[model samples]
Target: MSLTREDVAGIARYARIALSDDELTEMTAYLNDAVALLEPIREYDLEGVEPTFHPIGSLVNVMAADDAAADERALPLGIALENAPSRVGRSFRVPSILGDEGGAR
Candidate 1:
C-alpha cells in the first residue's frame, strides 16, 4: 500500500505535531519513498516455508557451557565489594530516588 499527503497530514494532526506546508509535503514524499523500498519484499514466494523465531535455525545456547567455567573463575565476594562506594548485604546501595521514605522501596 502507498501513502498520500492527506494520510501524512492526518497522522501529524493525530500526533499533535505542527508541520509547515513545506515540511508536510517533504515528509509525505519521504515516507512514500521509504515504503517503495520495502515493496519488493511482497514479491517473495514463501508459501511452503516454516516461520521461525530467529533467522538462524542452527543457533544454540552457548551460555550454558560458559556458566560452568564462569563459576570456577568468579571473583570472591569480599574482593569484588572492596571498592564499592556503598553496599547493602550482597548488592550495591544506590541513593534513594523520588524522595523515598528511607530503606528499600
Candidate 2:
C-alpha cells in the first residue's frame, strides 16, 4: 500500500520525528517501496517449510571466563601519571569549565 502525505505525517508524529516536506517526500517513496517488497513475501508458500531462526550458519556464542587477565605486568599509577601534561597530588590535572578553575569541587 502506497503511503499518503497524511500517513507520513502521522507516522512522523508517532515517532517524534520533525520531517521537512522534502524529507517527507523521500520517506513516503521509501516506505511505499518497502511495503511493495514485503507484499510479495506474504504470498510465499511456507506451509511445510520449517521456520529458520538463524539466517547465517553459526552456533550460539558462549563467552569465555573473565578470570583470565589479558595483560601481565600492568603499569603502576605513578608511572602512568608521569606521561600526563598536568598532575594533581596523585591524579592527572585537567582544565575546568564550571564555577571554579579547580577540579573535584
Candidate 3:
C-alpha cells in the first residue's frame, strides 16, 4: 500500500509530534522506502513452508513442585546507592538532560 501525506500527518498527530515541512518530506520518503522494501517479501513463495511466530523456538516451562521457602537476605538500599557515582539523599541522581543542558531532545 502507498503512503500519503495525509497518512503521515495523521501519524504525527497521533504521536503528538509537530513535524516541520522538511521533516514531513523526510518522513514521507522514509515511509515509502519501508513500504517498497516489503514488496519483495510479498512475492516470496510460502506454500509448503510452515508459519513460525518466533524465529527461535518458543520456551515451554517445566512444571515444578511449589513449596513455602524461608526468607532470603537482600542487599541494603544504602549499599545500592553507594555503587552509583552520583546520588542525592536516598535516590540516585542522574545528570540533567532537559533543554537546560540541550540534551533531552
TM-score for each of the candidates:
0.41, 0.44, 0.47
Residue-by-residue lDDT tens digits, candidate 1, 1-105: 677889999999999998899999999999999988887888999899888898899998665454655686677888888899998899877877656776564
Candidate that scores best on lDDT:
1
RMSD of 2: 9.3
Candidate 1 Cα misplacement greater than 4 A, ranges: 14-16, 50-105
Backbone clashes, each candidate = 0, 0, 0
RMSD of each: 9.0, 9.3, 8.1
lDDT of 1 at 74: 72
lDDT of 3 by residue, 1-105 (tens): 778888999999999999999999899889999889889888988789887776777766576455434324445779878789878888987766564665532
lDDT of all predictions, in order shown?
A: 0.85, 0.84, 0.80
lDDT of 2: 0.84
lDDT, candidate 3, equals 0.80
Off by over 4 Å in 2: 13-16, 64-105
Ranking of all predicted structures according to TM-score, beginning with the best and ending with the worst: 3, 2, 1
